[model samples]
Target chain A: MEALVASAIGLLTAVGIYMMLRLRTFPVILGLTFLSYGVNLFLFTSGRLTVNAAPIIGRTEPYADPLPQALVLTAIVISFGMTAVLMIMAIGGHLEAGHDKVNMSDTDDDTPEVQS
Target chain B: MLTAAWLVDVAASAVTGDAVTVKITHWHGLEAAALWMSLAAIGGGLMALGAYPRLRALWDATPRPEAKAIFDGIIEPLAAACRRLTDGVHNASFSRAVTVAVLAIAGAGVWAFSGGTHLAGDRALLPVTPTVLALWAVMVIAALALPFYHRDRVVALVLTGVVGLLIAPLFALFSAPDLALTQISVEVVTILLMLLALNFLPKATPVESAPGRRFGDVAVAGIAGAGIGWLAYAMMTRQPAFDPISHFHLAQSKPGAGGTNAVNTIIVDFRGYDTFGEIIVLGIAALVIFALSETLLRSPTVTRRLGAIAPVREDGDRHPMMLVVATRFLLPMAMMVGVYIYLRGHNLPGGGFVAGLVFAIAYLMQYMASGYVWSHARQRYDHHALIGWGVLVSVLAGVGAWAFGLPFLTSGFEYVNLWPLEEFELATAAIFDLGVFLCVLGAVLLALASLSRLGLRTGEDVNTRAFDINPDAAQAEEVR
Candidate 1:
């Protein structure tokens, strides 16, 4: 089970990194999503893998680590905020620049500089 | 000898405790005189040897690496390599930078892993059920398919949603009901936000990268994935290096925080400061989005571009009557559920964060069922004010602790018996949770509302009524 989860985290990370490297804003955002998943999962697993051990007292003998869980919970929400902000910036950039390319090549002088 | 005699006379005068002078007559033939003379001769001979022109010339003519040259030889190439690396990684191309960063991180991970001693942990692995395996397979396949279908933006989003949905169940299976709940609700809001932004974005991503570049990216991504996966697996299989501090939280949860849910207690009580900072960050993020969107709308270029794009929903019934009616009915029930979740959060899996998301989703439903114009017209509260007040309330809750001579955000709880109700635990954390609830609710709504403002620029017809076709109007028309 640990192997399965670890493999899943890795795969998600791989997918995220690949997507993030794409030359468009949208794919980068998607990549960030995948990356966040991998990261959140990684952090959660830092408490070690446990089953049927919710952190609520008196329900289970040994409870799962609440510390990591709390941290991951905030991370998930914060990542959402980050994604929203990134998406909006992407929209604004595409609007002003008339293109959504993530890179600006110095050799390609035809494209206008993005307004400050 | 004369100088030695003078020294002896001074010493004898001091020993006699009077001004009497004594002469040293037997200074010569002492063993110390011979030893001092031989030491002076050895020093003088070494000085003479160094002064020899032939030896000085030989030393100067011998070839050796200069200290400066040796230092430069070791440092110059290293400095140049660092320069080259930074140039490659920061060449203004996002993809290239990301690729380099991923590979570098993976390389570092491998280096660290190889440097450490490893032992297979004695901990036993859990047995995987078929249901879990199936879910995992689906999640993996969906994630893998994302990049392939990503050019088709909506398909990629659906795949992302699938992966996110699968994660919630996995959390549930792993005994993190709070996480599962949070994940599920957050997924809905995220997809909705994306869908709104998608209206302005290009439907398909252009294929621009060269085939070779893409292949290179795949290789780098694979290495990173493998490294992180192996690291996670290694850590999970092994016992923690030291005992976790969760034991302290678990033990003190009921007695110290007066909550059965250690996770909840940690968030609102034990680690309330972190939570406070988190909520403030969330509020700031929402405010930034709102501010950016407002700026974007004001820009003539953006407004013109938005106007030129075709409307997202051209010919559909803008507000489906059934969805509108159903959502209208569900709003109160959803609010009730949010209240219930918020009230029980101290002891249960539900908390302010999830409840706040629930309320946001319910309100979002109203916006979806009706139109933004209709919903905005009826909204009695300002999003900015909600955020401000939420923060103020949380600050007040924290400050309330100071009145009792307790530190900030120190929660105090008691079992209170009220009329027509059995004894129930009332905690200051609940008040703090209320602050969290309001902040989260405000932040989510504010962000989504800000994004939806873009829809207004599409020149879609603004609806004044909740639904386009009113039942009373139809009945009156039939009677006429």
Candidate 2:
């Protein structure tokens, strides 16, 4: 089970990295999403894998680590904030550059650059 | 002679426990005469050596590596190599930099792994059910297929959403119901936000990278994935390096924080300061997005660019009557659920974070059912003010603790037996949770609303009423 979960995390990370390496803003943003999932999962697993051990007191003996859960919980929300900021930046970049390409080198003239 | 005299004075001081006042002349003896003669012989030998020009010249011309020159020789190339590496890795292309960063991280992880002692943990592994295996297979497939279909932006997003959706169930299966709730709600908001942003972005990503370059990226990505995966497995299979502090939290959660849910207690009580900082960050992020959207809308170039792209309007009712009516009823029920979740959070898996998201989703549903113009017209609360009030309320709650001579966020709860109700516990942590709830609600709504402003710029027809076809119009015709 640990192997399965670990492999899933790996695949997500791989896909996320690949997407991040794309030349456009949208893919990069999407890649960040995938990467955050992989990251949150990695952090959560640091508490070690447990089943049927919810951290509510008096509900289960030897509860799963509440610390990691709390950390990941905040992480999930913070990642959302990060993604929103990235999305807006991407939008703004696309508008100013007149292109969605992540790289805006001076030599590349695929689209006319509009001065902001 | 001086050394012999000093030694004699030290002996005297040690015996008398006083300052060194014994005179050298008083202690002078045959040993002092021998010491003076030896010092004179050494001084005369050094003076004779100084007079020898040949010996002095040889000493000056002796061959040795200059420390400065040798240091430069070793450091100059290293400095140039570092500069070259930085330029090559961090060139203008973000993609290349990210690729380099990924490889570097993976390499570092591998290096650390190799340096450590490895032992298969004695802890027994959990048995995987077939259902879990199926979910895992689906998730892996979705993630793997995302890049392949990434050129089709919508498909890629759907695949990404699929991966996110699968994660919630995995959290539930792993005994993190709070995480599961948070993940599902966050996923919804994220996908919705992305969808709004997608309206302005190009629908399909253009293929720019060469096949060879893509293949290289694949290799790099594969290496990173494998490294992280192996690391996670190794860590999960082993016992923690030290005993986890979660036991302490679990033990104190009920008595100290006055909550049955240890996770909630840890978030809102034990680590409330971190949560406070997190909410502040969330508020800042929302403000940034809102500011950017406002700035973008004001730019004539961006406005022209948006105008250039033809709006893609599907052949369907802008606000379907069925969805509008259903959501209208669902809104109140959803709000009630959010309230129930928030109130019961201290004892259950629900908490401020999830409840805030729930409320945001309910409002989001109304926006979806009705057009932005209709929804925006009805929204009375200012999102910015909501965020500010949230922070203020939370700070006030924390400050309330100081009145009792306790530390900030020091929660005090009492079981209240009010008339017409069973006994229930009222906690100051709940007030802190209220602050969390408000901030999250405001941030999510503010961000989504800000993005929707871009949609407003796309020249879509605005709706003044909730539904496209008013139900009362037909009744008015019969009266006429």
Residues B1-480 of candidate 1: C-alpha lDDT, one tens digit per residue: 554767777787899877766665554554767768988999999997878898778889999879999999989999999999887766677776777678788888898889988767777898888878998999999998997889999999999999988999888888788899899999999999898888888999988989998998898889988889999999999888888888899999999999998999999999999999999999999999999999999999989888877766665678889999899999999999999999888898989999999999999999988978889989999988877887888899899999999899988999999989998998999888888899989999999899788878875667898888888999999999
Off by over 4 Å in 1: A108-116, B1-89, B470-473
Best-performing candidate as measured by TM-score? 2
Clashes of 2: 0
lDDT tens digits by residue: candidate 2, B126-173: 899897899999998899899889999999889989999999999999
Residue clash pairs of candidate 2: none
Every model's TM-score: 0.84, 0.85
> TM-score, chain A, per candidate?
0.93, 0.91
For model 2, the stretches where C-alpha displacement exceeds 4 angstroms are A106-116, B1-89, B474-480
Model 2 native-contact share: 0.88
Indicate the docking level reached by candidate 1. medium
